[model samples]
Target: MLLFNTAAADVFYKQPKTCPHCQSEHYSLTNHSKILRFTILPVIPLSISYQRQCDDCGYMTPVSWYALPTLEMLSIIKYFAGVLLLGYFLIQTVLGVHQQTTNEVSYINKPKLFDTYFVHADKFTDTPKRINNLKVAQLVEFDNDNMTFRVGNYTYKYNKDIEIAMRTSMLVQDNYFSSKTMTFRKEQIQQFYEDNSIYKIMRPELYSLFGGFVMHPPKPKPLYTGVKLDKHNQEGITYFKDGLYTEALNSFTLSAEGGYSWGQLNLGQMYRDGQGTQKSLEKAAYWLNKATQQGNLKAKIELAELCLSYDCSNLNTD
Candidate 1:
């Protein structure tokens, strides 16, 4: 159970409404809030839900749409909390954007040695055919008419991982840069800025942090639907491909809990391999059995192999 889930009684109604379970005329409305907190104090209201409890029978049911409270009728705590929480972040974001814009404008106009230019991967002549979206080009030489850059051999897909794009530690000796160099004409550089292809320009000092404002967005809560489960399974596969075993395990667990057969199979395999969590043959058998029950042929084969190594006679594979 979460630590800060709290429900508060809001209003009491003695109207001519009857409870479905028991014919009670008295009911109390309550608000259940999922809160975001700073230490012990509630900072923001993440979500709110309403329920109606019968006074006599103590039967609780979700409040009906027609009987729900209006926006004005709701508590002011949410609005007040939102203002306090968002105000600081808003100010920081604005300041950060201002600083970033000033740096970009300054760096672009005056070329300097080893100044980094964030550009589309396609701008590099020898970028891998895998369609890596973002690439860094460090300024090496420039004159009045043309500018040459030592393009990093690595290319990356543009995601939340902004810092990794400019990390010098990623550069290795031989494969760091190609023997050939890419040069852009002065007019082409101007065209790239006009077309928004040259996204960011910064010095080595700015590489430590990528975004203007420092913030870590929360991972979304998993939904228990077929589509959502499939997405989780796919995400798990991607994580596993990237050797992020812990993250892969988490995604697989969410998908498996939603009764996705592929997720169950993958989770069972991970258990067998001890990829993220400790190996447990019992847990492996349990998940593989679940997937097998759903007619997953791969899981059946894996379970057969697992049984050969472990004593499956007493284990509850079902």
Candidate 2:
């Protein structure tokens, strides 16, 4: 049977009383995206997600679940592969050969499908929504015009609810202590507490189910991180574009450290070519390797080429 948990229970709530962190009701929807399974045997969803931004206290919460309830996630495909491998091994044992009769048994491969792409509907137009098995209402937030979330490897969209929640959460988180409407609403908060399901996550091992819940700060998506990186990277690009090679080198260095591999590769190329800086094949190789680890394919090829043309005594291929 499929038995895996996203720890969503610890992340979201069933009947939330108040803002878990600030104990306020001011919240808005921020963004959302969905995970798709690319299997041809059946069209299924891997996960459904709702990214909620608290309206009252500027907190973000993630709500998600297995899209396919019936399929045992771990056993769905891998289990069958293991079975095939075992069958092949058994047949080989009887034949007294370590190899297969026709071809070696290998991992069953599947074709990539376009439907495997995550389908996203964000809060930019309306509050995109879906109720969980517990009937908990979830909202999808998205940017109205961009239509893409642009998070780390994943993207989320904007929605009205998400915007509202974000606005509310920002206000609450930043100015709750100074809000003119600081009067507490105990009754409404209590009911919300009853509905929230993620309350238990605060103390998974320490607290009992009946104990009170603890609140956590919202985690910003990589998109936000990417924005910071972009700002720095853009500064470097501006410098480089204007032929301010030295300034460009410094700016690009900061951007690369901030997780922009594109910046890293650019800096390496500069070192290799002696454009703005002195010719240093070693630096080029080091930075290129770093960029490649971040999935910069061009960096990989460039590094390889550097090894063949120059004496890479300082560079370690490993």
Candidate 3:
């Protein structure tokens, strides 16, 4: 339950004043103050009235407006300092977010090195686990068609309560374990922005305050077209060619979970053939269908063959 009440108090301060009743210069200034309160806490000021009292005779009279010094008025203004500070803080926060958003858009279009993007990890892959969903991708290189990012190995759970300090940690050097990088098409990056998958972008220049270059000089790492997902898919193919079906299946599973259509197709075949696991037509159809949706023609053929025995009517073959 909420309890509200107004309480008044007379704040007395020593001030030079001539009391009308006593004709004495020794007087105290007092304000008849009332405040709106919630429970035991004062919420706001309601009203205030000023008067002067002679200390020697205990006589009270109205305050004289002409006698109040400029410094005294400034003292009264200090009472509203809390309210003023609160207003300024709120305005600054709104402007800061707006300016940062503008900077992100500008940075994204220009494609600078070391520009960091805070993104949803699940969106980066097709079958992502929820245990760790918040991730960051730092820009490494870009071309007309595609842009590459060094993805962080470490991930955190996303929530509204997560603070900026936690998010900023994603950009720290050690997070990009094993120098893993992922490349995305320019069109896909645009789609990510449209879907709000990328929430914040921080530029390399922001790290100068911490002496980023002087602390750790940038070393040129060789760029490779084979990202993690593609590498997994290729590894599966090599294992399959070498008659190592179990290893092929394991690699394919990793690749498929990371959103590789070819990996999905190969993994479906392994399930159907019972190479590494039991032959389950249902599982085959499920994975094959996923690949087919991503425009993999080989998966369509395999899925159609699997449907010859299983119920194609229940699957999304079209």
* Residue range with the least summed lDDT across 10 consecutive positions in model 3: 208-217
- Sort by lDDT, top down from the best: 3, 1, 2
Q: Show the lowest summed lDDT stretch of 10 residues, model 2.
A: 107-116
The model with the greater TM-score, 2 or 3, is 3
- Compare the candidates by TM-score and give the number of the best one: 3
List, residue by residue over 84-133, the lDDT tens digit for candidate 3: 66679999999999898788778777787777677887886443758778
lDDT of each: 0.71, 0.46, 0.73
Q: List, in order, the clash count of every candidate structure.
A: 0, 53, 0
Candidate 2, residues 1-318: lDDT per residue as tens digits?
223212111122323335678877754333243222223122232443445566667787764434222332232343244356557889879675433212111100111111011122232112344441111111112222211111112122433332343334321233212112111133322233344321111111121112321112356565554423477778989998898989998988887777788888988898999877899987888888888887779889988898898776776555
TM-score of predicted model 3?
Answer: 0.49
Tens-digit lDDT track of model 1 for 51-133: 77787999988865356656524453542464576788999999999899787777767877677777777644534446567
What's the CA error at residue 280 for candidate 3, in Å?
84
TM-score of each: 0.40, 0.30, 0.49
Enumerate residue pairs that collide in model 1. none
List the candidate 3 regions with Cα displacement exceeding 4 Å.
Answer: 1-15, 32-47, 62-70, 158-181, 206-318
- Please identify model 1 stretches exceeding 4 Å from their true place: 1-40, 43-79, 123-129, 158-162, 165-168, 206-318
Query: After TM-score superposition, what is the CA distance of residue 290 in candidate 3 from its true location, in Å?
Result: 70
